[model samples]
Target: MLLTRTNPVIKPRTLTSIHEQLRDHGVNLFHTQMHEREAFKAMFSFGGTLETLDRAQVNNIDKAILNARDFASEVVDILKAAQNAEGEGAHLAATSAPMTSSKVA
Candidate 1:
């Protein structure tokens, strides 16, 4: 229903205009440090996890890891909310059902 995040990078100059256009359409964008960072790519290119990566080679490695943790936490919260809503919907449907009977000989 809404656009939350964007691709690898939207460019500094174009971000403002894009954000404004999306907002006019009732769409919100979530900007996170983990969205586009060199540290993330370095982890893959160097063949190692965030912790195992060499801080000297990758700038802002620590910040990138922290952002990743935060992003993951946000995802978990969203999933939990969706699950709760689904359960409530199911409960309502079950309670609103009509009773039916069949005759047998």
Candidate 2:
């Protein structure tokens, strides 16, 4: 999983190079929204989950929620694919119900 890391000030080119290297090694990389970190920081400061946060005060909140949903879907897909690869898809089915912002703190 990859979260935004701004501290230490690494160049974008370097970051992309590292990401490419990791992908070449068959590493699964999950990238959250660029401003998702800010949204989480707001959640901590305001003492509430994403659903409880005021949309008017947060920027790109809708995108953040969509990003979360996409990430969750990708994870479930990977799990199901792995299960099928191991011949356990019939015995152990991986499933996920739709999630609300309140459920994704």
Candidate 3:
């Protein structure tokens, strides 16, 4: 009997790495916009409530969040296109596979 052994080492992508990739793809606003959103979230968490914030502050926060979302969507599209170009379903296959080991006695 023959046993098949598969060992795959996958490195998780970091937010900074992803942001760099997005920048390489010409979507440079992702990091800045994400930081803006995070700042808004921190403010809201520390502050009493949204009602306590001024109208302009709220609007700016909303706009920052929306911009971040839009930038993220664009990054997704760029990554999908790159995966498709490399090979159809390549990304899916890489992510789904697990390392395996077999022992025989």
Candidate with maximal lDDT:
1
**Please, what are the lDDT tens digits per residue for candidate 3 over residues 42-73?**
45566744335555545555555555566668
Candidate 2, residue 14: the lDDT equals 71
Candidate 2: which stretches are off by over 4 Å? 1-11, 31-37, 88-105
In order of listing, the candidates' clash counts read 0, 0, 0
Across 18-102, the per-residue lDDT of candidate 2 in tens digits comes to: 8789889998677542333566578788878777789888766666666667767877888888878777654444444454476
Model 1 lDDT per residue over 1-105, tens place = 223333444546576687688779987445443456677888779988988888889888887787788877877877899999999999999999897677786
Worst 10 residues of 1 by lDDT: 1-10
> Considering every candidate listed, which one attains the maximal TM-score?
1
TM-score of each: 0.72, 0.61, 0.34
Better candidate by TM-score, 2 or 3 = 2
Count clashing residue pairs in model 3: 0
Which residue runs of candidate 1 sit more than 4 Å off their true CA positions? Answer: 1-14, 31-35, 102-105
Arrange candidates by lDDT, highest first: which order? 1, 2, 3
**Each candidate's root-mean-square deviation in Å?**
4.1, 14.7, 16.8
Candidate 2: clashing pairs of residues? none
Clashing pairs in 1: none
